[model samples]
Target chain A: MPEVSFVESLRMTLREEMQKDPLVMLIGEDIGRYGGIFGVTKGLLEEFGPYRVRNTPISESAIIGSALGAAMTGIRTIAEIMYIDFTTCAMDQIVNQVAKIRYMSGGKMKIPLVIRTQCGGGRGNAAQHSQSLEALFFHIPGLKVVMPSTPYDARGLLKASIHDDNPVIFIEHKLLYATKGYVPEEEYIIPLGQAEIKKKGREVTIITFSYMVWKTLRAAQQLEKEGVDVEVVDLRTLYPLDLETILQSVRKTNRALIVHEGCRRNGIGAEIACRIQEEAFDYLDAPVERVAAMDVPIPYSEPLEKAVIPDEEDIIQGVKRVLSRN
Target chain B: MKEDHQIWLELYRMMVKIRRFETLTGELFAAGKIPGFIHLSIGQEASSVGVCSTLRPEDYITTTHRGHGHVIAKGGDVKRMFAELMGRSTGYCKGKGGSMHIADFSLGILGANGVVAGGFPIIVGAGLSIKLRGTDQVAVCFFGDGASNRGPFHEALNMASIWKLPILFVCENNQFASTTSFHYSTSVKSVAQRSIAYGIPGRSVDGNDILEVREAALEAVERARKGEGPTLIENRTYRLRGHFEGDPQRYRTKEEVENFLEKDPIKRFQEFLKNEKILNEEMDRQIWQAIDSELTDAIRFAEKSPYPQPMEALRDLYAEDVDPLFQRSLA
Candidate 1:
């Protein structure tokens, strides 16, 4: 096994998929020669050439709509919207066209497309470039949402997403791109909607995903020294949420703490917390606590941005609050 | 520029078919046989028929909300289209998508979009698919003057030009965006003029003249198939009917509507055929009678077809098996 950065794992997976299937291609702005804004597609243009790795204009609507069209026409396309926040510019295409085409067409058409975009804030890119909008896409049907926390999960899940017959919104955390993780050299796939236990404990269950998964894990490690055991569940796929794993964890631990970087109001955590309470009402020893970003536009200053988004301290506090009931 | 009599006759027949079908559709909607509001292209027959006549069955096309003419010209089955509008199980979308969303993938009709300018970017992708597959087939996009001002229109044109993709953008400048005239809404004088900003060949034609529209379409289609990239042709025409069914004509005067009706493409094409000695009163009557009988059969088919089962609403949401939760509930 070799260690690889999250972005490197993505590039390696893209290269492998493109080589394995001719129908798989990429279309985005500055992806070809510029190798992508996040460098996730650094050498793909040179390796795959311009035909397969297409650089489109600064047109988010066309970028996504064209990908939807191409996918319907028998090409599996991976389109990159530079940032998830910019996805608002092409909301109609994503919400109305891509998400509803299969259903509206009565399954006569299949849109095998993956919209890859970066989300999260930690480098002070401000509100525009940094937003965790998984909640928006997860709300729509006919779309599969995947957010990977590790390079191994990123490579495996993206490979699975490329082969999926439906439309997928593959979200990458900008802060996690450079983080290194152990990835297998052999070809493998981690099926979507499967949760991975980063750390096992029985005192409390901390269910999170994306960059927040790492924060929760670090907090769990810190809590171990204080004799408080915490189980951290990384939800790799958000839409077809692996509630089975979440419910089981809650049933055993009897306490649930859902953490995410998105705002708490109507966030993904709210939905998960509701489900946990609904299914494991008898097992829960306390109410499900949620620690999410404050409901405000992320500020440009580093200190203010850090203050707004949830950190390891927030996760630790949330865990202690939930464990206090027992 | 001598025209082939047989081709001219066929074009005339298609134009008449489109005209008669739309007229009957308007009646059906008025009688409450159709469920949703429909946008008719009653006066823009020549542009749709003329352009589509030059396309191969393998080529693809994307249409606007007012897309009945385009569907018919592209060889869509009239019975299925009627069934679609009637919300029957036999429709192209199995009643899920009504008039503005009918699609026939087998005939390469990408779809009819309800959103203005939605087809612009979609056609660009179709063109790119053609290029990647190494096919010479072209993609045609039918949009109105209102769609020309949209962001996707500019993005698609620019992308198509830089990539040298095979696409033909046919802008039906019908002089109205709902109630606002193109003259008031659009900054440029002609929709074709905007194409020059993207460095593509652009031309304007008298859309009511079937021959001119066909000739322009032929040139553009040829350029696309040869990998010469996209061309924008603005078909200067008029909307004979209100924007949609039940649209009060308070926005425009009755006199203005009468002036546009005078240049109805079907009527002009009939006169052109007669002047060329290819059609006479007898031939014209025979054509109208055949179209009437065909439309009668289509209406019957729609009326007789059953509505989709209520349970079918849950089906077709995903090609793969949906989560067991949805499956169990639907089951």
Candidate 2:
């Protein structure tokens, strides 16, 4: 086992996948000589050459659309949109074309595509770049949304996503790139739609994913000092949702608190909270609580941006509120 | 243009098949036999048949909403198309995709896109695939003047050009984007002119003339197969029918419709074939009769085919072999 940065895990996985399967290729803006904006695809172009690792124009629609078309044929394409916010430029391609072609074609088309992009705040990138928009893709039926919290999860999930027959939205958090974790030298596969219990506790359950998983873990530690036990469940895959794991945790803890970086209004929290109440309503000691970003654009100023997004303190407060009930 | 008599007659026959098939589809829609709305390529047969005649079955094509003609020309089965339109299980999309979405990947027909410029990016991808696989196959995208104004159009053309991908951006300038005419919507006088910015060879032709359309398409296809890159061709044509069946069509006057009706592509091709002594009145009548009987059988097949079970909707959204957890969630 070796400790690898989150970005290395993804780069190594992509390189291995491309080596294992000749059909795998990468295409996006500044992914070639300039490397990816996040440097996850830094040396891929040189190793794979230009044909396999293409540097495309500043055309998001074409990048996604062409990826869909190539995937319809035999190629497995990993298309990179620079930011999750810019996915709107290719919304029709992702929402309508990529999502529906397999169904529309009646299983005649096999789309082995992974849309790789980064999303998150705390860098003060402002409204256009910092918002978490996975909910938009999560709402689409045909897409599989994967958000990994650690380098280990990122490596395994990305390898699985590359080989998956359907289209997958492989979203990465910008802040998670530098985080280091031990990844096994041997190949491993973390199947999508599975939740991991990051920490074990008894009183309350904190359900979160991606970068928020780290925040929730820290919050859990902080609460432990005050004689509060908090359980953390990191949802690796958002779409299939791993509701069974969530229910089991809620049942044990007798309370649930959903935390996410996306806005509280119609965010991932809302869905998780509704599902918990719907399925595990009888097991609850308190109503499912949500701690998420304010329903406002992420501002550029540090304090303003901090005010907009949820932090460890917010998760702690949310858990206390859930425990304080009754 | 120098195609032999049999090739010319075959082109003429395909044009008639498309024209008659579209006419039958219109009738079926009017009779309430078809469920959803349909956009017919009645007058734009020359562009479809002519361009498709230049490619092999392995070559790819992505067409617009008014794509029945392209599908039929690219060797799509009328029985399956009608079955799809009738929402039967045996259709191309197994009733999942109606008139707006029909595809047969076996023939390299990447599905007909319902969005205005949706096929542009897909076709570019097909071209990229051909280049990556070291195949000489070419991908053609048939869109309208209305589609050329969309964002995908700009992105697709630019990307295809920089990569030198083998694609043909065939614009069936049917003069209407639904009710909005290209005259009001399009900034350029000709859609082909925009190709200049992409550094590709582009030309506009009389879309009603099968010979002219074929000649331009042959050159473009040849260029693509040779790995020279993409070409943009604007087939200046018209939508003799409304954008969709049951459209009130208040945008254009009756006189305008009547004016274009006289320049119908099928009629013009018939005249050209007759002038070349390739098709006489008897041959022409026989062609129509053959197409009519074929369409009759196709409609009957569509009518007799079973409708898919309602539960079938949950299937095919992803591959059957996906995680059972995802499948369970779908239900």
Candidate 3:
């Protein structure tokens, strides 16, 4: 096994998929010559040339709409919307056209497309550049939303998403691009809608994903020293959520603490908490707790931004609060 | 290009077929046979038929909400089109997409979009796909003068020009975008003029004349196939009918509608065919009767077709792994 950064894993997976499938192509802003804003698509232009590795103009709607069209016609396209927040410009293409074309066409057309974008609030990039918007796509039907927490998961899930016969919203955490994880020398694919138990315990279950998974793991380690065994469940996919694993974890632990970087109001954590109570209510010894970003725009000030987003302390406090009730 | 007698007769026949089909559609909508609102292309047949006539079955086209003429002219099966409009299982989209979303990929008919300027970007993609595959096939985007004002129009035109993607941007300047006239909404004298900003060749033609429209389409399609990039064509035409069924004639004066009715593409084509000695009164009557019979058979086929089972709504939502998790609660 070779350890690689999340960005490298993505590039490796893209290279392998494009080599294996002639229909696989890349189209987005600065993805060709500039090697992508985050350098995730570096050196691909040299390998694949400009035809397959296309660098499109700064037109979000056209980028997504063209990707949707190409996917429908006969190709697997990965369109990058540099910042996830910029997706608002192409909302109609993603929500109305790409997401509904399969259902609307009655399965006659398939949009094998992956819209890769980065979202998170750790950096002091302010509100527009930093925000977790998986909840928006998760709310839509006919779309598979995948958020990987590690390099191994990112590479595998992205390969799977590319081959999927449906549109996928593959959201990357801006902060997780440099995170290193062990990826196999051989190719592998982590199926979407599957949860991974990063660390298992018996006292409480901390459910999180993407960057929040790292925070929860750190908090879980601190809790281990204090003799509180906290189980961490990293939801690799948001929609088609791995509810069975979540319910099983909650059943074993008898307490659930949902953590996410998105605002607390109507966030993905809220849905998880609701489902935990609805399906596993009897298994809970205490009410389900949620640790999420404060309901405010990500501030420009570093301290204010840090204060708004969930941290390890918040996850630890949330777990202790749930444990205190029991 | 000089069209022969056979080509002129074929054009006339197609124009008559589209006119009769649209008229019957209006009648069916009034009789409560169709479920949704229908945008009839009563006066825009020449533009659709003429442009489609120049392309092969492998060439692609993206149409607007008012896209019945385009689909029919592009060799779509009349029965399946009627079935789709009637919400039957035998329809092109299995009744899931009613009037605004009919498509036949085998005939290279990309789905009609409900958005005003939706077809622009999709056509760019189709053109891009053609370029990537190293094929000479071209993609045509049929939109209105109103759609030219949209962001996608700018984005698609600029992208297609810089990349030199093989696409034909056909703007059916039918004088109205819904109830608003082009004069009120558009800044330019003609939509084709905007093509200059993107560094593409732009031309305007008499959309009612089938031969003229066909000639212009031939040049553009040939240029696209030669990898000369996209061309903007402004077909100066009008919508004789109201934007949608049940729309009162409050937007435009009745005189304006009557004036456009005088320039009806079908009648003009019939006159041209007559002058060219290709079609006589007897032949015109026979063609009308044949088209009427064909439309009647299509309606009967649609009426006899089955409605999709209610459970079908859940199907086709995903291609694989129908996710029993969501279906369990619904069941």
For model 3, how does the per-residue alpha-carbon lDDT over A1-326 read when each residue is reduced to its tens digit?
A: 66899999999999999999888889999999899999999999999988898899999999999998888789789999999999999998888888887777667987899999999988899999998888899888889999999999998899989988888999999999999999987988888778999998999998999999998999989989999999999999887689999999999999999999989999998888988999999999999999999999999999999899989998899998999996
Which digits, one per residue and each the tens of the lDDT, describe model 2 over residues A96-178?
Answer: 99999988888787899999999999998999999899999999989999999999999999988988899999999999999
Q: What digit string (tens of lDDT, one per residue) describes model 2 on residues B137-211?
A: 999999999898889999999988998999999999999988998989999899999999889999999999988
CAPRI-style class, candidate 1? medium
Candidate 1, residue A298: Cα displacement in angstroms equals: 0.9
The 10-residue segment of model 1 chain B with minimum total lDDT is: B322-331
Which segments of candidate 1 are over 4 A away from where they belong?
B1-3, B321-331
lDDT of each: 0.91, 0.92, 0.90
Model 1: iRMSD? 1.4
- Worst 10 contiguous positions by lDDT, candidate 3 chain A: A101-110
- lDDT score, candidate 2: 0.92
DockQ for all models, in order?
Answer: 0.69, 0.80, 0.69
Ranked by DockQ, the better of candidates 1 and 2 is 2
The sequence of per-residue lDDT tens digits that candidate 1 reaches over residues A141-217 is: 88889999999999999998998888999999998999999998889999978999888999889999999988888
Instruction: For every candidate, give the share of true A-B contacts it also has.
Output: 0.64, 0.87, 0.61
TM-score of each: 0.97, 0.98, 0.98
Poorly placed runs, candidate 2 (over 4 Å)? B1-3, B321-326, B329-331
- Model 1: lDDT equals 0.91
Candidate 3, residue B271: how far the Cα is off, in Å: 0.7
